[model samples]
Target: MDALHPHGMPKSAAETEARRLIADWAQQPDQQPVRHFPTAYRDTTPLPAYGTTPPVPQPDHRIVPAWAAGIAVASIGVGAGVTGIGCGAWLVLQGLASVTLTSVLLVTAPFAGLAMVTTAVAGAVGRIRAAVTTHVYEGPVTHHTEITNTSHQQGWFTRTRNDIS
Candidate 1:
């Protein structure tokens, strides 16, 4: 139909312009059917009721022995330290506080290096080799602990007693 009469009474210039745009937009490939909403629905939905509860996890008593804590902490520290150095270098490159970045790098690099060295030394010394014997019987103590480097290489051995007499 005719877009606009030279002297149309009610239709404004904006309505005419918008009609032309919609006419043009209809020809595009990826255009969707557009609809305008006057107002949004405002309300909260009733929450759903639930039944069964999740089971709690039982803590395993047979965990890494206390002696292994140091090695584990050291290993994790060294790993985190290395990651920090890399992040510090990146921050320094990204034009962050250069002084702070440099200080972090200086601190973390040495700790990372020292932690790696100590981890290696402690691993070589086999500090993780520990023995724990629980005495369940009151009369006689039957707990044997022996560390033998039978194999040429390093290994771990654990022995535990759990009995009531």
Candidate 2:
């Protein structure tokens, strides 16, 4: 027995009419409403995937802090000055201790004077460099950027042609 008409063709006019109404409703498109969705959500196509994941972006790591640079410059300047002064003094004292006054004056004075002059020049240069040196930053920097990249994939044997009149 057909499940849709268990009792055979409708025996009453009302049953015949009811069956016709259901058939008509089924034929109408309104009976099954078409779902509406935004374009972004409506796509059902699967994206092509490679075995490897996209590379993770690496942040730049070579920056040196300004405070460290300043400290380094200051230390170098101080060391150069101290070395210059100390060596000059030691040379003069050694000459005075070992030699007669006239000999010490003749043999060591010029050498000591040269040493002190060289040291003075180095210190002055260091002081000028420190005063002129510019620092990159006092703190870490945070940067933001927006990028839009578009690429077209072309097949082998494809050619672009231009026509001119």
lDDT of 1: 0.72
Candidate 1 per-residue lDDT over residues 91-130, each given as its tens digit: 8788654458777798799899999999998886675453
Q: Model 1 clash pairs?
A: none
Q: Could you give candidate 2's per-residue lDDT for residues 1-165 as a string of tens digits?
A: 333445565446558789898898888956676789767534455555957554446899887899999999999999999999999999988876887778758988899999999999999999999999987768787765645454444875555454332
TM-score winner: 2
Which regions of candidate 2 are displaced past 4 Å? 1-60, 99-165
User: Model 1 segments beyond 4 Å from truth?
Assistant: 1-60, 96-165
Error of 2 at 96 (Å): 1.4
Error of 2 at 81 (Å): 0.8
Using lDDT as the measure, the top candidate is 2
TM-score of predicted structure 1: 0.20
